[model samples]
Every structure is written in C-alpha cells, then in structure tokens.
Target chain A: MTVTSPEKAKIELRDVRKSFGAVNIIHGLDLSIEGGEFVVFVGPSGCGKSTLLRMIAGLEDVTSGDIFIAGRDVTELDPAKRGIAMVFQSYALYPHMSVRENLAFGLEMAKTPAEEIERQVQGAAQILKIGPLLERRPGQLSGGQRQRVAIGRAIVRKPLAFLFDEPLSNLDAELRVSMRIEIARLHRELGNTMIYVTHDQTEAMTLADRIVVLRDGRIEQVGTPREVYEDPSNLFVAGFIGSPRMNIVDAIYAGDGRIKIADTVMALGQNFAGVAAGDGIKLGIRPEHLNVAQSSSTALRAKVDFAEYLGSTRYLYCYLPSGETITVEQRDGRDLSSGEEIFLRCDPERLRLFSTGGDRLRSANTAGMPTA
Target chain B: MARTRNSSARRLFANIRYHGFGIVVGLLFLAPLVWSVLVSFKPSVEARQPPLPPWPVDGFSVQSYDNLAQYGSGIWTYTGNSLMVSAATVVASVIVSLFAGYGFSRFRFPFKNALFVLIISTVMIPFQSILTPLFLILTKLGLQNTLTGIVLVYVTLQLPFSIFMMRNAFDAVPKEIEDAARVDGASVLRVLYRIMLPLVLPGVVTVAIFAFLASWNEFLAALILLTDQNKYTLPVLMAAVRSGQFGTIDWGAVQSGVTLMMAPCLALFLLLQRYYIRGLTAGAVK
Candidate 1:
C-alpha cells in the first residue's frame, strides 16, 4: 500500500481553484501527478473531475493557484502550448472531415508540413488500428470506430501528456472492455503521462497506475488501485473503489478489546488496549472476505434475500436478523438460494474498524497485518 | 393473399388521391405564372383572350417581345439593378448576421439579451412605420435612387431575422465542437469561420436565399427609394407596369415584365430548395 515510484514531480497543482463568476467549482486542489504515469481522477457525475482535467489542460483558467507542467509554470498557457492533447467523450471529431483529416487537424493548425502531417496521421491511424477507416467521415463510422479516430487525433499530436474525459462511456460494454485494455496497452507502449477522468471505477482501476478519488470537488484519496481497494484510507475510498461495495456495519466497542455487532461479539486482536468500552464504531468487510468457517469466534444468523448465479460464482444478498443487508461472494458450488438460513463468519484480522464518522480506525493487529 | 391485394390497392388509391389534391393546389397557385408565359408569346391583341383552346398557338408571335424591347423594355436595366442590390444584400447580411449570431449564441457579454430582444422585436414592427424615417436618413446620406443605398435598406431590413436565424443555427452547433477547435489551437474567429461555419452551411444558405428573395422582390421601399428609371429595380419597374406609361395599358410589356421579375426569385428558390427546408428544420433537432 505504501509503494511509490519516481517521476513524481511532473505535474504540480498548487492550490488550484476554478470559479464561474461567484460560484466555485474546484476548491483548492493540490495533487502532483507523476511523469509517464497513467493517473485517473474518478468520482460521481458533477463532482468536477472533468472540470479539473480541463483546468489542468489550460482550457479552463485556474482561478487561484499555479499549474506546472514538467516543472514549468503553465497556468496561463494555451492548451496546445502546454503540450497536452485531449480526447473528448463525444469524440468531437470534425463531422464533415474524413478520419485522416480529423487526425491531422491539430498538426495542420500548427502548420506542421503537409508531408509530416500525413506521416503522423498515418502512424497514429496505424497505432489505433483505424487505418482503413481513414477515408470515412465520422457520420459513416460506428461509434467505436469514431472513438478510435478521436484517440488517434490525440495521439497524432504526440504531446507530453494526454487527457481523456470518459472516452469509453458512449461505447457498448464489449467495446468498453476492449478499449480499456487498449488504453492500458497504449500506456505501456507510449509511456507518456496520461490523466483520465471517469465516473466508472472499473475503468479507473484498470487504467490508472494511481487513482485520485474525488468527491464534490475535493479529493478524498490518492493511491494505486490495490491501495485504494484493499487499504482504503477512509470510508469514501473503500466504498467507492470496489464492486459490491465494502459492507459497513454498525458496532459498539465491548469491554476487553472486543466489539459487539447486533448479536455477535468479535475480538479486536488486543490492538485497542488503550481504548475505553462502549465506543460507537463501524466494521468494514469486503464481501469475498466473509466466509463460512467453523473455527471463527463470531457468527451472524442471516437469511438469504436473493442469490445471483454467474456460472462459476454466486452472490448471496443476505439479511441479518437486525435487518442489515450484506452480500457474500461464494466461488465454490453451493446450493445457496433465497430465504435460506446460514451463519456468516469473518476472521478477526479481516475486519476493518472505523469511527462512526466514516474514518477508518486503525489498530495494530496482534495476529499480523490484514494481508489483502 | 386477397386481403393483401386489397390493402395494397387501398394504399395505391390513397396515394393517388393525395397527389391529385396536391396537384390541384399547385396548378391553382401556378395559374398566373403559366398564363404570363403564354401571354409573353401571344400578339398584343391575342394576349387578352382567355387561356383556352391552347391560346391559338398558330397565331403566336414574338412581336410583343420585340415591341417591348423597342419601347425600352428596360427589363434588362431593372434586372441588373435587382441582381446588384440582392447580391450585395445577401453577402452583407449573411456575413454580418453570422458574427452577430455567433456572439449571441456563444458569448455572455453584457447587454446580450437586451440586444437580441431588440433585434427580434424589430421583426414584429411593420416596415411601413420605419420607411419614412429610414428614407429621411437615406436622403441626408444621399443614398436614395442608388443601388448601394437600396441595398443598405435591404440589409438593414433583413439583418434582424438574419441574426435570429444564424443565432439559432449557431446554437444548434455543439459548443463542444468549437471548444474542441479552441483546444486544437484555433482562435475564436478561426473556430467560427472554419469549423462552426461549415457545419451550419445549410442554415446559412437558407438565410441567404431568404435575403435574396426579400431584396429582389421588395416593392414599397424600392418605389420610395429609387427616383430615376435607370436606378429602377425589377419590383419597382413591375409595379410601373400596373400603370401604363400612356393612358392605355401596355398588356404585352406588363406581362413580360411580371415574368421577368418572377424568374430570379423562383429560380433561386428552386436551386436551394433542399437546403432551405432543411435549414428551417435544423433548429428543432439541435
């Protein structure tokens, strides 16, 4: 979770803020994205992820702080002068132009020689595998092809960085997954610094070397996918990063390093000897960590509300007697069905303790650190 | 199979009835123009005969056309004046309104709403009310009876609707496209001219056609403006035909004059018909 890499001083945002007249969109945000790294800014819609990307691109003015690209202040530079290219969600390809012209437009605008522009356009088309579609207009191509042309347009610019805003959002599911892998592969091939913004966590997780989790215009966490998923610094990151979001249950600190949740009593592994009793807390558990084990000290009686069978795996949405719902991911073949009664168990080390205010409460595990 | 045949026959019959009614309406509207063309070929006396028995084709002659030409058809001069004024008005109106439209659609400067409302409001006011003041201003500028002066009036009269149409057209063009152009290193003017303009060509062409027809066919203002026959536009000259030069009417010349005036407007309409309708419908979708 603490792993870090070099090139960490590439892009620096020094207390950046964006405002439209009286209303501010981005509060003072300060995050340095490293060079040659694929960083994704993710949040729900209207969280200003796209706005922040545009601001960093110099398309939107940073109302307060300075933006530095490659250690040089570029707060007032134009987007092209800032050495960045962007892929818009709508593809933004010139509808009247052929794919070739779309890829060559920025270069043409910069007056790159006709021959050089042709070479770059062809090279980008070949890289995106849109070579055959070079003659086709945006209106003629499929959505996925148009998206590739958009990415090709950005690629032909060959800038220091690439900014993408929900580029795969308009594609079908099958194309989305392929494009996600293609983007990751592109990062591998190009090794150029890329900043992507999306509301979809899977895209953020798969494409990002480091993911910046945002909420309502402020960043909540900045970490790699593994760090955000398995060792979230707060409740927001934990709940936002994973599919079948981490199950958070209410608990009260019982006497002698134990916590009580509904009717079950669980040990906290002696890390909380300095804490008092009856402190209100929350327990965080990932669905896959909830197992059926006879050796566990605590158990909850749950009735299955429903079960989803996805061939090799099953997801049981179980309701405890206290009326709290929890999802259990089962990989083994089991006859788990709706309304079935079973006891759910989790290891003491696997349980995450949080304050009532949605902050993870860390304690030294006597057994060892919870290895994810 | 019989049911299918009956349904097919019913659809065919419905189509025929629909087209038949449309044809009747079209014929009724076109009756005058057709009669004008036929009258252009008839002798001065025969032109008065009702359009029946094919209008005595054997008796048809070009004497009227020759006489009208000899008696100073001035049709050529009128046509030249109309063409000059209309062409200038179309070009000037399209370019000026394009800038105004882009401003109203894209920018948020002060007084934008008030200015736009003022422009659109002028459309509702009758042109006759402003003609007097407008004429006075033109007289002071020494613009009356000249093509440039008349074109100024045409452009001024048409700019309001041009601004409204072009604004709607520009509004229909996605802001993202222009923003993309900006990020692609295009300045605002470059974005407007190169990217936004091409995408809204249908709307622009439609507006140009409207301006063309308006200036070419404008009668009242041209009558008030042009004093000399040399500066007479087609509409003003066509109106002159309604009152003959002599006490008696010159049916031959009047008929030919009416046809001459109608040709440019109709030809331009037919040429850009598709774009015209499409431009009108463009605002709805975008």
Candidate 2:
C-alpha cells in the first residue's frame, strides 16, 4: 500500500444521521477534519460521541449519510479496508495471542510478506517501548502494558488515520496522564489525522488541536480549547467546558446597559438589544473571574459557606441573600471562615449574558447585532 | 494453655472424621469395579464357585479372558465395531454442535431464541420413546444394520447436550474479541477456526467424551437396530455371555467382558476430568 498524502488524509462526514428503531442516536451532523489535525470529540455520556466514532470506523452502520476517508466514499466499506485503525477502551487485545502476534495480526490478515510483517511489528514495538513484552500474552500484562500493545497493534497497520474510543479510561490516573502525553507525542511524530473521543474535559483541553463539544447528539461548539473556554457560543458550552464550572446567577435585565443580580444593579459595559427592560436573564461568570472586593459599594454581598484549600489556591463556595450559590477562586492566601460575610466583584467586561432559553445574548457592538 | 490444647485436640478429631467419611464414600463406588477386575483374573473353573475369597485362590490366570475371546464371532470384531461407531459419533457430534453453538450464541435472526428452545426441548423426550422412529428413519435412509446408522443415532442423541455446553462456552467469551478480530481483517470462518475454537476447547472435549462413552456403552439401540451377528457392540456381546450357552452361565466370560467395557470410560473420564468439570460449570456462575 502506498503512503497517503497529507491532502488525501482528510476525513469528511456529510449529513450523517443514525437511528435505532424509533429512537435517534445521532441527529444530522456534518464535519470536516483537516489532514494532520488532532480533533477531540468531548461530550457527556449518551451524547453519541463514541457512537459517532464507531460509525466512522465502520464498526457501526450509518442509518443514512456518506463518510469519506482519503477522499474516497467509504460509508459501506469494511473497517479494515477503510484505511483507519481504532484503539478500543477495553484494549480488545486477543487474550490468547502474544504481544508480537497481536501486533502482527492485521498484517498477517493482509497477507503481507513475512519479513515485512516482522519489521513492522518490531517498529511498532520500539515506538511503544513494548519490545521487552513481545513474548507475553495480554492476560499476563498490566493495564497500561496491554494498552501499549493495543496501540502498537494499530500502529503496525500504517493507517491513514487513527480513532481512539476513550482509550485511557481503564488505566490508573498517573498512567492515564503518562499515556496521554505519549499519544500526543505519537501524533506529533507521525503527523497523521487523528480523531479522539473522551468525556474528560481536561484531556480535551490539553490534547486537542481543535475541540468539538457535543450535547444530546448535536454539536454545541467547535473551536480551539481557549476559544471555547473564553468565548463560548452558548450556555451549555459555557457550563460544560470549565473545571470548577462557571457560576451562573439569575438576574433581571435593567435598561441602560445594566443588569440587576440579587440586590446590586451594575453596568455591564455593553449594550444588549436582544433583551427588554425587566426581562429575566442569566449572568455568567467564571470562578476565577470573581474576586473578593475591597470595600466597593457596587459589590454583591454573600456569606461564605465553605472553602476548599488546594495548597496554591482556594475555592470559596458562597451563598447570596437570595439563596443563589456561587464559587469564587481566591489565590491571595487570605483565609475566610465559613459563614463569614463577604463582598464579591467581577469586571464588567468579563460578564456574559444569556437568555432564559439557553442561547447567548450577544452585545450590540458584536458583529451581527444591531446597536442600541 | 489448657484451652488451646483442648481446641487443638477437637480440631484433629474433626479433621479425621471428615476424611473418614470421604474415604467410606469413595470405597463404596470403587468396590464393585475392583471386584469385577479381580473376578476376571480367576480361572474358568473356580470363578463359578461362591464369592468367598474373591481373588483367584486357584492362582491368577488368563483363562477367563481366553474364554471371553472365543465367545460369539470373537471379541476383537465387536470391539472394533464399538470403536468405529463411537469414534464416528464423537467426531460428528463435536463438529455439528460447535457450529450450531457458535450460531446460537453470536448471530441474530428471526425465531432464534424459539429455535434454540425447540432444540433443547428435545432433551426432555426420552430416547426410548424415539428409538422406533429413529429406526424407521434409518431404514428409509438405507442405514439399518450399518455402523453408520448407529453413529447417526448416537450423534443425534448427543446433539442437545453437546450444543448446550458449547453455546455456554461460546457465550462465556467476550463479544469484543470477535469484533476486534474482524476489525483486524479476519474473515468470519478464520475468526471461528483460529480464535474461537481454542477458547471453547474445554466444551468440545466435554462433548466428545460424552458422545464416546454414550455410544460405546449403548446396548439397546445396537440390539434393536442390528440384525448381523458381526455388527454387535461390546455391550450386546456381554449380554449374550451373561445368558450363557445351553443353560450354563460363563461367569468368567461375563466378568471379563464387564472389566473390559469399564476400562475405556474410566480412563477417558480421568484423563479429561478437569475440562469436563470446567465445561459443566462454564456459564453457571456468570
């Protein structure tokens, strides 16, 4: 087989839809992944991330649509003939075969020359650092070692692309992190288009060249990690992307570029033409964005309910008078006891507004909005 | 110190009692077999006497075996017939049940569960009740009085249990293994032969042993279906020896035949007992 050019390695999904009986698993979705790009699909369970990956791998059938790999329509092709390899969550190693046989299985099936199969197997073993484990069976190896054998099996195939289905989920935490770095390094060294599925947002943030956030079988946002984190397109993406999660407070829109939260009314430093005066809206702010205010009249008053100390920083879980809870990241080393009264402030420019229906309410000055 | 010593003594007594009961049960099962073996070694004339001093008091001899060898078209012919029929039955049953079990465990089609239940339901219908029908079917197929007929009937009889064991064995293997193989470019038949057969070997051994023993020891079918004297299995020959020639019972020949028939079954069970137990309990817990 000839090596695929970078241009020919692009994957395109056109209007893909999957349904089982009367229930729909994936709604119509269209995506194009560029050659040599590392894309991560992040979603909650049942959001069809893994299902979509399987469909692309040809392990699952497409109810309707076309899937293109290396510019060829392969929606109905066998998984092996589609020029892609997948590393499964369970490792899916043949328990009876040695690590060497496991790596050589696909090449043997393809009827490659005996010497070439040996060389490729050795190369994959060297790449995964599993050369010492070539004679051991999958049952005799640890979780991480089995995972390397699984990846080595995929690598020997020299596929046009690689699909990973939550491959690190079964390992211990420390091993997961190390394997994650190894996978990233592998992508860099090989420069192949790779699509990864995971529910770990930290992994998505750290590994993805581009992150596709999905919810309920629909794409919520597609962007770089920083873009999705700092400028989410909607409320779901905003709430789902961050670690300690962005805090949301119920607020009423007051006219003249202002919003009323709990009892304090503050200028938002932006004009919103999508909302009327006295209309209900949600105020979004990240934990790190909210700070302990130093005697400001415009600050919101809250009582600290708890503080979680993480050595370098603390998270203050506070409750407003209206019974709304919020978390504030404190890094100044000042300690505040539970039930202590405190004032919180956020930069006006950092505030985000959302309609009650969960869509972002863009400010008037942003593109595609009418100025007030 | 006194309490510890008393407890230690009590534990020792309990241990002896437990093992003593086990030994009693073991001997109860082995005693008849041991007696038959010893009686087969007695001289032809002394074997007819009372059971006192069960061993050959006149001196151990091959006279009973020689006597058994001379009865009814000779012993080797019947032994060969039994061996061929039993071996054919084992091979046929293993192949048929393995494919059937893989299908039932892995594939989905209309009436799959219902069909499996139907196959398994045949086990409840006693073999005696169906023997006449089977005989008639074999006659229609021109198989009566042939070793092939006996083998066919035995394989059919072994199907329900063999397939059940094999399906359980296949079900115990994870489906992801097959998926992985297919993704690795293995064809379906290759997957079954190269991967699945090794994993389900214990179940195959279990099926083969049951089929061999059942066909080897079966007497009624051989008697009812076969009309030729040369086609008699060992059990049928044993029955003839028990009836005796002209009102005189050949106790020596009968004891020798019994001993010979018991050897293969015991050896097979002992040799593959681990697989048999594992296959029996394969899906019982999971």
Candidate 3:
C-alpha cells in the first residue's frame, strides 16, 4: 500500500480545443504544468475553466489536440485510466454506499486485494478524520462530512493528481475558509499536482501556487499570487485579482514625460514602448495606493459618495471630475462626509497603464517602486 | 377575538367539505368490490335477483366459492396461468424498461429523442386498431395458444409507460453521480445495475406493479392469443364463465371470479402504495 510519488508526473496540453457543433468553447491552448505544482484556474462564469479542467480529466472530449499526463499521451484514455481523481462541487458520493464502501469502491473495481483495500480505506478515513463516519451513508452525513468522504474516496486511489471543480463553493463562508486551509494542507502533505477551478479570487489568491486567469475561453495571465496582484498582464487581471477592484480611468498621453487625466497632468519617469502624445490609454491604481492629498494642480479632485468601514480599513467611494468612479482605501479612521470634495494622489510608479486593447504596458523603471 | 373566531369557523367548514368529498370519492371506487364480495357470499338464485345492493338478502355462504371449480379446468389452473403470465410480464417488462429507461435518460444517440417518441407514442394507439394485425403476426410466429404470446403482448403494451416511469426515476439522479461511478472504473452496465438501479428502486417497483396489474386484468389479448382452454388467464376464464351458454348467467361464479382477480391487485397495491406514490413524483420536481 505504498503511495506513489507524484513529483515525476507533469501534465501538458498542446493546442487543445473544444467546440459544440459550430460554437467554440475552448480555443486552441498550450500549457505545461510542472510536477507537484498547485495550479488554480480562476475566471468568470462561461470562461471555460471548468470545461478545460474536464478535458484534462478526460470527462470531456478535447475536440482537437493532444494531452499528456506523466509523459503519457492520454487524449484517448478513459477517465479511470488517466491516473487522476476528481472531487466535484456536488460531492457526488454514492448515496446508497457507506463511506467505507465509497472509499473502497475504486480499489475494488481495480481488483485490489481485500486487505489492501481495507488498509487504504482506513488510511484515507483517518487522514480525513472521517473514521467515525465511515459506516454511515452519504445522506446521513453533514455537507462538510460528505465532502470529506468525497476527498477520502479520491485519495484512496492515490492518483497521480487531484482535480477539484469548485469543491468549496457549496459550503458556508466559515466552512469554506476552513476547508480552503484544509485543502492547502492536504496539498502540502500529498505533494501531488492539483488543478483546482474556482471563480472566487480569494481562493485563487490564497491557495494557488500559480493562478491561471482565464477570460472568454482563453488564458489572460499565468503568474504567482504576488505577481498577478502587483504586476498583472492585462487590465482584466488587474481588475479581477483584487477586492475593491483596481480603479481604472481614461487618460491621454500629454507629452514625452507626462499624462493628462481630466485636465490634471502627472509626470511619468518611465518610457512606454508604443505610446505617443495625444493617444488615449487607461490608468489603473489599486485602492490602497491612492491617498488624499492637499488641494494642488497635480492631484485629481474627487467628491466622496459613500464609505464602507471594515474594522481596520475604510473604502471611500468617490467620483472624479470626469464623473468616473474611484475607490480609495483609508486606514487613518478619518470621518469623511459624503459629497465632501477631496484631492487624491498616488506615486507615479504605482500606476498600471493599459493600451486601448486592455493589455498591460509595463513601466521600464518598475525597479524603483517599493514592494508590498 | 371576532376576527379569530371568523377564521376558525371558516377553517372548520373547509375541513368538513374536504372530508365529505373524500368519503364520497373513496366509497365510489370501493362500491364495485363491495358488490362483488356480497354477491360471492349470496346463493346463486338470490345473487341473480340483485338490484346491486350493498348487502346480500340471503344469509352468506361459501357455495359460490365452492362452485368456482366446475368452470374451465378449475379455478386453480386459471389462477396459476394468470400468475405465470403476470409474473413473466412483470419480470420482462421491468428488465427491458429499466435498461431502456436508463439508456433513454442518460445516453445520446442518433435519433434518440425520435426513437423515444416513437416508443411512447405506442401508448396512444388503441389496442383494437392493432388487434387484427397483432393476431395475424402471432399466428404467423406460431406463438398462438401459448402463455409466451400473451406475456409478450402484455409486456409490449406495458412498456411505453414503464419506460417513461423508469426514465423519470433515472433522471432524478444527478449526472455527476454517474460520472463519478464511471471515473471509479465502473463499466456502463455496472453503473446501471450497481449505482443507478438501486437509486431508482421505487420506479422499478412501480413498473412491476403496473405490469402485474395490466397482465392480470387483460382480457381481449389473452382471449385471442391464448386459444387453449388451459392457458386462459383469470380474466379470460372469468369472461367465459360469465358468458354462460345460451341465456343463463351464474352470478355467483361470475362474482367469485371477479373477487379472485381483485385479491392479488389489492394485496399488491396495499403493500406497495408508498413506492407507487413516490415513483410518480420522483422526477417531477428534481
């Protein structure tokens, strides 16, 4: 009953695509996931992250290209033969089977010996702390216990990898937080390549070793949590990765060293490759980076519309002179009345510039900026 | 206080009306069974004099039940034949419809919906319209006068609704459960028999009960297909006994035959009514 090390099993997708009749779902995509990496696919609904994960799991047809799991061509392999186990959002435990039976089912199907099956089932139950619930049916258990039984069922297989399809979405907020930590701990202990799909950015930010941001069936960015948060690849990633999302506003390239936004000019210390004078662009600033400044020509003027106070920090919702909405994070506990005019400023290097097409334009002087 | 009293009075009136209507409808269905039982107890001479009253005028006796053996190879032969035909029909129909139902509910194939529609549409065609053709087909197949032929016809007749009920039962199970089973290394047939079938047990019981009742009470098909006197089911023998030679009808024998037919159906329904109701509402919401 030795558990196989998953550190040698890498998964790669080469030009994989999926379509339903004439409607394309997943566009041609190529990605290589290193062994033992915990990758999270994060996207809005209809972004095809679930479809992509299902394709990798062999539950869905690839429609076009090849997939390799542990250097084996698995495009034609059955799901059971693919050496992976999946924990579904609905838990999908056999309602008629006891937890012990559920955990032992896959091994039984493989014709494993009875002693080994018992050993593995008990081992999984102990790991999941479901030993007391082992003899109970799924309907008799609570939601969290049912999910634990589901994970136990997966782990008894000792699969090459684990696929989670929004496994925590059905739990309450408190349970979701606790279960998220449990899964991260499980990944650390198991050391298997895990591909998790969720639309919640917090799950992506907290649990992922690398988050693959998807939009409209295509990958928008792939980076570590800090990289995606501070140095996003596009406007979508910038707006998607943070809570109280990054503020985006229309701006114009005023000249060689400055940008103009609603008649207020700011100096830039870095050169952008394709930007020219009088070109329209978008400027993004994280809420925490923007702060109140004394009235000045260089600062943007805004009137506070509302404030949401969370114990340590408050979000000041405001509108700019151009009638665009912006949020500023205020941790100083100052009481600002709605409709009070305020000037806001930020370090020029903290700004994220995007082209009209929404792709991020990196600043050459990024090294000067302080790290979070 | 006045408003509360008004609402309570209205609720009391509604309860009375509800119970009253239920009592009337319940008795209306029970009346035929009561009449049959009463007639079975009365002497043949007094049974023939009935205006179909609720009770027998003469004192009750088992004379009619005693007289049941003189007609058509005895009551036991007819009962055995009926039991065999109905049991075979239930087994065949339940198995065929269980597979068909799971297939129709889960898998997609070319013209699957059209095929399902074609199968279900058979329920709408009157048996009389196909009687002549069915007779000729059974004759050509050399299945005439055999219990197999009648069982086949009963199963064919019961399949449309049986499949429909089974499909709904399987539909109530989420697709993810089946996917999990498959990923757990179950073959398609294993998934049906082991995982899916157990979940849909109520539907299976419902199908079995329906097939049982349909084959048990079916008269015309059995009368035509089962030309052999020994092969006649309960209803066919009952019909033969009721259509007494010339103009004489043995009311006692006829009523006893009916009570015999009613006994098994009643026993089955009483035992499995819970499953029947559960199956009917199985996929209605989920």
Candidate 4:
C-alpha cells in the first residue's frame, strides 16, 4: 500500500453550514485539518459531528460553503471522487458478498485490472488479518471481524483520508478497546489523514492527535487531549472532557487575589486584575486536585455524603456548607464515613476560574502572594 | 419410574394428536387434485358416470388423456401458447417492477410519494372493469389477437402487486448498505444490478411466480383478446373442452385437462414456497 504524504491529505472546511428545511444543523464553521492528523470530533448526540463528517465525505450535501480536500475543491464531487473512504457505525458490509468481494468491490467498480485488484485485496486482507475468512459472507463473521472487513474495504481504496463515524460504538467493551488500538495503529502505518467522530470521551482522549469538542452544532474547543483536559477553554469544555468531570463551585472574589468559598477564604496565587471584590465567580478543580485537609481557617468545610470504593481509589462525594456538592478523588485508600465533617483544600495553581457566563477567566499575573 | 412412564405415554399421545390433525388437514386439501388425477386415468365409460369411489373401479386406461391430446389445435399448441404468454409476463413484470421498486424505495424526486401511491392505488381497480378499454387500446396498437398483447395485459395487471412486493423487499434492506456501495465507487445502475438484485432475490422470485400464475390461469383476457385457435392458452382451451361437442360435456376430457392445468401451478408454488412466504412478510414486521 502506498502511503499518503502528509501534505497531500489536508482537509479544510470553509464556512460550512447545514440546514434541514426550517432547522439548522451545523452553523457556519471553518476548520483546517493538517494532513495525516488523527482528529476526533467528540460531542453528545445531535451535536452534528456525524453530519460534519458526512459532508466532508460527500455522503451528505453541503447546504452552503465549500469543502476542499487535498487542495482540490470537492464540494460538488461524488463521494467516490472525493478520495475519502468512510467506515459506517453499522459496518455496512454487503451481506450477499464474500469478505473478499466486499473488499475488492471498489476496485472492480473502478475497472482496475483483475490481477491488480487481487494483489490489493490480498494486501488489505493481510493488513487486517482476515485472509482466512476471505471466502465467508458477512453473516458468518463476528462483529469485530465484520468491522475489520469494513475497514479493510476502505483500505483497498488507498484513500487520501479516512472518515469513521462512531465505528466502534457497536462492539463489546473488550472488542472496542482492541479495535480502537487497531485503528490507531492503522492510521500510523498508512499515514493518511483521519477524522473520527465518537461520543465516547475515552476514544477521543486515547486516539485523537487533536480533539474537536462540539456541542449544539458548534465547536466548543479544539485542542490536544491533554490541553483540553488540563486547560479547557470554557465551562462546557471543562465539564465535558473529564470522567468525574471538573468540580465547579460558586465563589465570591475578594479584593487582592482571594476568593471565598462558603465560610472559608483562601489566597489565589495568581492575580485576577479584571475581578472585583465581592463579584460572583466560579472555581473549577479536578477531582484529583482536591485533598482532605485538617480543619483550618482557610480550608473549606464539608460533610462526606458518600464514599465510592473502586479497589485502587475512592471517590468522596462531599457537600459543602453552601449546599453545593463536589467530588474528590482520594487516592490514599483511606475510607471516610458518610455524614462525617471534613475540610478540603487544593493548591491555588491547580484551580481554574470561570466567569458566571461560562467563559474561562485567565490569570493576570504569575506572582505568588498571599492575599489573606 | 411410574411418573416417567406416564410422561412418556403423554408425549406419545400428544405426538399422535398433533400429527393426526395435520394429516387430516393435509388430506382435505389434497383430495380434489388426487380425485381429478385418479379420474383422469379411468376409462372414458367409467369416468363419464356419476362420481363414486373417485378412482377407476375397473382397469385404468389413458383414453381421457388421449382425447385431451386431440383437442383444438392439439394440446401441445395450447400448452406452448400458455407457456409463452406466462414466460413473457414473468420477464416483463420482473424487470419493470424490480426497477420501479428500487426507485420507490431509494430515490427522491418531486411527487415521489404521490407517484408511488398512484401506482399502488391501481391494485384497487378491477381487471374486468377495464377489459373493454384495454381491448380497444390493444386493437388500436395492432396488438389485439396477439400473444404479445395478452402478455402486455398480464404484465400491466401484475405490475401493481409485483411492484408492491418488490418495494417492500427493497425497503427492508438497510440504507447504509447502499451508501457503502455508492462510496465504494459503484454507479446507480451497478448498485441495483450487482448489490441490490441479489439481496432481493426472494422478492423477485415471488413477483415472477405471481406473474406466471396470473397469466397462465387467466381465461377472460385470453378469451377476449386472442382470436386465433392456434394461440389459445390452456385455460381457454380447457373452457372450450368443458363445453364439448353438441353441448355434451366430456367428463373424461375435462378431468384430464383440469389435472394437466393444476400441475404447473402446484409445482411452482411448492418449489418456491420458502421465498414466497418470506417475500410476503418482508417489511410487514420490521
């Protein structure tokens, strides 16, 4: 198989918008995917991730704006001519055809020579490790085997880019993990641009070179997995990326880089020049960042509502004095009983501040100064 | 041990009861065909007598079959005509309905739903009511008194139902399969011929059987449209044989003709029974 050079696989969407009669699906959106990048579009259902992928694949028409693939304007091209292959969520293999025929169908349609088609089919079969099952129809294969055949079909095309629409969504948990790894390895070996759309955050975090987080037909954040998880751009990104999700608690910003949570006031190490004293702000912290602290004037007091044990770590579901609940990741394996009073504290640098309107508030200075 | 013995006896009785009911029902349906076949084998003198102990009481003879063979333009000519008309109808109906069903199930165009409803609604119109107009139209087109004309009429009559069955079959296939084909570089026609036609084979078989049976057994249209004695189909020829010479019905010849006509229909339904059942219930459940 010929590798697609990174330069020849770039895909760009220019002010694309999709509407269905009276309702709009994808608002005007522009995005450039570098060649050979494994980009995952992660969002909840109805977020237009699949719609965007379909438009790029030419399966769905672009309501407005243009799609350029490999420096060619392919907005009016047929799906086959777009030089992209897609693996559907359902692994749509032709039931009547053998696995070999399903993989060779595209080349046959293109009128390639029989020997050449055979060689390519064999190569794809070898790559997907499905040679033994070539003569069998799709009905005889397991779900994972069928998915491999679907991908193998795409591979024989040697497309410039591959688009996968929740391809692993139908597999069992163990198979999903293995297939995810196989897909990641496929991208690396082929060096083709890939756009994967999935609702599973684990898939997005583990497989994406860059993740595009979407919500309500709009992009919420586009960043590396680590970047999105560690430094979310807004409250939505912060809440959507993590498993236990970031703990968000309402706070009142005090003068001179200090914020008050319930009855406890702590010094915020970073300076917030735009914040005013007594202004309502939101404090965001990951579950792992919150630690059980000794009772002190600075530590926030809370009652442990529930402790969930997961063999290695426990999650402390705590209720603050203000009646807001937050989760803490306790890694020391110490168990805390429900209804016990506790105090929680975190390093100021591990904190994130969000405006009440859901935008992230960047710190104004790096100087560490206690503002008690 | 006593309980086990009792349960075994109950099982045996249940089996006997179940199979006994099945055998009675099966024999009830088979009785008419079996009786006609047995009577057709009887001597003309005995077959013409009142129906009793349906089989030939005396030695069996092929005299009735011999008489049937000598009817009209010969039984072979009529059988050939019926086969030709039925074959033509099946081919035309299958080809037209296959494409029509694919279009109805997959494509989008202006008034698509309305067009489909219009095609399907034709099934509600009775064939007898339109026979006069159809005859006039065939006469104008120079197709009257022709086997092609009979086939054309049968195909038209078969279309509404054949297309319905075919559409249901095509509709039951997942749209994703077609999408996968199109993305795999198959053209519209290729997708229908290679991918789709194979998947909907049972539906096509069902449609073909219906077309063949409809054209084969039809008497009114064939009688009204065909003028030549050489072109008379089995059903028309059988009608003529029933109203025998000088108003004297030949019971032996009628029995032989009935037995002959019943063969092909029964054989076809029995041969394609699996596909027939599946095609009827294609989209009814899912």
| Tens-digit lDDT track of model 3 for A1-372 | 233356546888999999988999998888888889999999889999999999998889889999988888899998999999999999999999999999999999999999999999989988999999988999999889988998999999998989999999899999999899999999999999999999898999999999898988888888889989999888999999899899999999776768898879998776775678889999999999998989999999999999999988999999998999999998778999999999999999799888888977766455344332
lDDT for each residue of candidate 4 in B1-286, tens digit (9 for 90 to 100): 9999999999999999999999999999999999999999999889879999898999788999999999977999999999999999999999999999999999878899898899889988988999999999999999999999999999999999988888889999988899899899988999999999988989999999999888989999999999999999999999899889997888889999999998999999999999888888787785
TM-score of chain A of 4: 0.95
What pairs collide in candidate 2? none
Across residues B1-286, which tens digit of lDDT does each residue of candidate 3 receive?
9999999999999999999999999999998899888889888778778455646777887788888877769899999999999999999999999999999998878899999999999989999899888888889999878888888888999999999999999999998899888789988899898899889999999999999999999988887777789888999888888888689988888998888889999999999999888988897785
The model with the greatest DockQ is 3
Ranking by lDDT: 4, 2, 3, 1
Local error of candidate 4 at A209, Å? 0.2
Against the correct fold, how does model 1 do in TM-score?
0.93
Best lDDT among the predictions, by candidate number = 4
What's the TM for model 3?
0.93
Candidate 4: fraction of native contacts reproduced: 0.79
Give the per-residue lDDT of model 1 (tens digit) for B1-286.
9999999999999999999999999999998888887777778777655556434465777766665664444567767788899999999999999999889999989989998999899889899998998889999999867889889999989999899999988888877777677778888888887899988888899889989989988999999888888888877776776576667666766777777778878898898988888889887864
List model 1 lDDT by residue over A94-131, tens digit each: 99888888888898889899999999988998899998
Residues A146-239, model 4: lDDT tens digits: 9999999999998989999999999999999999999999988998899999999999999999999999889898989998998888899999
Instruction: Give the number of the best model, judged by TM-score.
Output: 3
Candidate number that wins on lDDT, 1 or 3:
3
Better of 2 and 4 by lDDT: 4
Q: What C-alpha lDDT does candidate 4 achieve relative to the native structure?
A: 0.91
Q: What is the lDDT of residue A278 in candidate 3?
A: 89
Docking class of 1: medium
- Pairs of colliding residues, candidate 4: none
